[model samples]
Target: MTEGIRSGTAVGSFWAEEERCGGRAVALPSWLLTTSNEEVAATVARLYGGQSRSRDRQQDLFELTLDNDAIAVNVDGPEAVVNRLVLQQVEEHAPIHVCDGFNFLQPMDNAGDPCGCPESVFDRKAAARSGRGPKPDARLAFRLAAAPDLVIFHLTSSTWEFSDSLSAAVAGMERGDNGAQMTISLQRKAVTTRSGMAVSYVRPILSVIQQEFAAPGQLRLAA
Candidate 1:
């Protein structure tokens, strides 16, 4: 390992990084669901396979890592069962921002997308600071060849109760239960870069999702 750092040798992730302030940054840790490395690998490869092979095939596959314990659940797709199953288990819900994890989401160099979508929490933070609320990346959703392929549903609960049933609704519900959808902000991000599209999951996302569904828990400031 270089510099005595293991630099995690995962096929689709980055080495854990720390910011200038010594705060940890961009750690593409995965809390794998029923989704197997094989399934993720297969889906990603299939999505990007037909395209002319490039030296860097990495960009096509997205990497979302949740704090191992934070993920209450995760479901994999055969592209048959439905991607909604995957959303059911998610607990991490940080907003994307440019300064945070979503540095990849800036104006694209090409006409692929006129506006840059968020890639990570940093991108969400930058957008939040601006007048705009949570905006999901359209291209990311559209790029996938599904009619209802990658829909992101935002669910907000009044009493702060997060139940598996609630997750089921978030993934599959077309309408919110009692303005619960109105309470939470939802956004979708499609990562496209030279290295291939990639997205990392952080704890803040979980916090927001939790806030939307459940009462505020103990507040712990980052060191």
Candidate 2:
């Protein structure tokens, strides 16, 4: 299926969305990497846990999945305590992006699917910062942080900790009970094409930057 929704699988995560929901979508697909010393997988986990550092084996791999109405993510490989990527109930039509390439698909979930979206699925009111861009060039811009230093962490069933910045850890809070994933990606896009985002939302750009190393191992979402 070049572009068809799929269901049924030991999903690491159905993948996350590609839209910058904070407001003013201003980024093109790009590549944001940490030093070779920083493990990519561990850096991914901090996303749910916030900015925390860990010396655990959780720093394995990062997986993103977007299938139908579901957006899943696994910060590290299996075996992490705060491992939670299995989130369903996403916009009906959304982008299924990874570090390589992605596509859009509508949801076909059944009764067992995650709940429904509390708000409008395609609500772009936040990400659509519009005014009058030089007569109107319908294109949004985002700055890409190239080779920023990233720190990945594992949240024990306890307090929050980080190897980078405290802001990263605080941002990882979801509903209230911060018992999940957290990762912070940094570098500095110089003149990034977009606005405020740590590292989690820069995915669309990462996919494009990984073109050269686009091998099976270099980029592949877990199933």
Candidate 3:
């Protein structure tokens, strides 16, 4: 799944259906996914685990801390199956330039792909030179990684829509007669300085999958 994500195949997906209040449903948060255990553990260990770190786990809630930055996972609400995960910087860091831009996409060349090919092109320099690109604004970076039912994120300056997709999928399940679940993956390169102190989360390489319904009551999942 991670490999597929890296090659730009798997993406956030959501399915909607209508179901009764009771059914077989599963909510697997990223932390609960075993495939990413090594990666997540290594990240924490390298970044803030050990002497400088404090960790705690209580039932469905888990927490890890390093200096002023912290990451937490807890059950999401009246819905015990769902989870809410968050990362926060206790003390704001120096402002950094963050830019969000769109580009014209190009068709993939399978022949050049395995070897080398420019899948999409964005003339950032040209835009900047022509004053078409917006001025860099001070902001933070947030990068996310995912595998099927799990998602991990590093606080920095990127946008994520995993929750939205999950909600849509759950809504679909609620509307369907049979139970449903989905798994998707995401991968993207993260940017960091030599010291690794200054970091930036690049935007995801692939587009997210989405589903929408005009009628609200058509499908509603458990809270």
**Candidate 2 TM-score, true structure as reference:** 0.19
Q: Which ten residues in a row have the lowest lDDT in candidate 1?
A: 78-87
lDDT of 2 by residue, 115-172 (tens): 2222331232222123111010111111112212232222111001111122232233
User: Per-candidate RMSD vs. true structure?
Assistant: 18.8, 17.6, 18.3
Best by lDDT: 3
Task: For residue 120, give model 3's deviation from the true position in Å.
Answer: 26
State every prediction's TM-score relative to the real structure: 0.17, 0.19, 0.22
Q: What lDDT would each prediction earn against the true structure? A: 0.25, 0.23, 0.26
The TM-score that candidate 3 achieves is 0.22
Candidate 2 regions exceeding 4 Å error are: 1-104, 109-123, 127-210, 214-223
Q: What is the full ranking by lDDT, best candidate first?
A: 3, 1, 2
Model 1: residues with Cα > 4 Å off, grouped in runs: 1-23, 27-37, 49-223
lDDT (Cα, tens digit) per residue for candidate 3, span 87-109: 22224422221222232111233
**Least well predicted 10-residue stretch by lDDT in candidate 3:** 1-10
- Model 3 stretches with alpha carbons more than 4 Å out: 1-160, 184-223
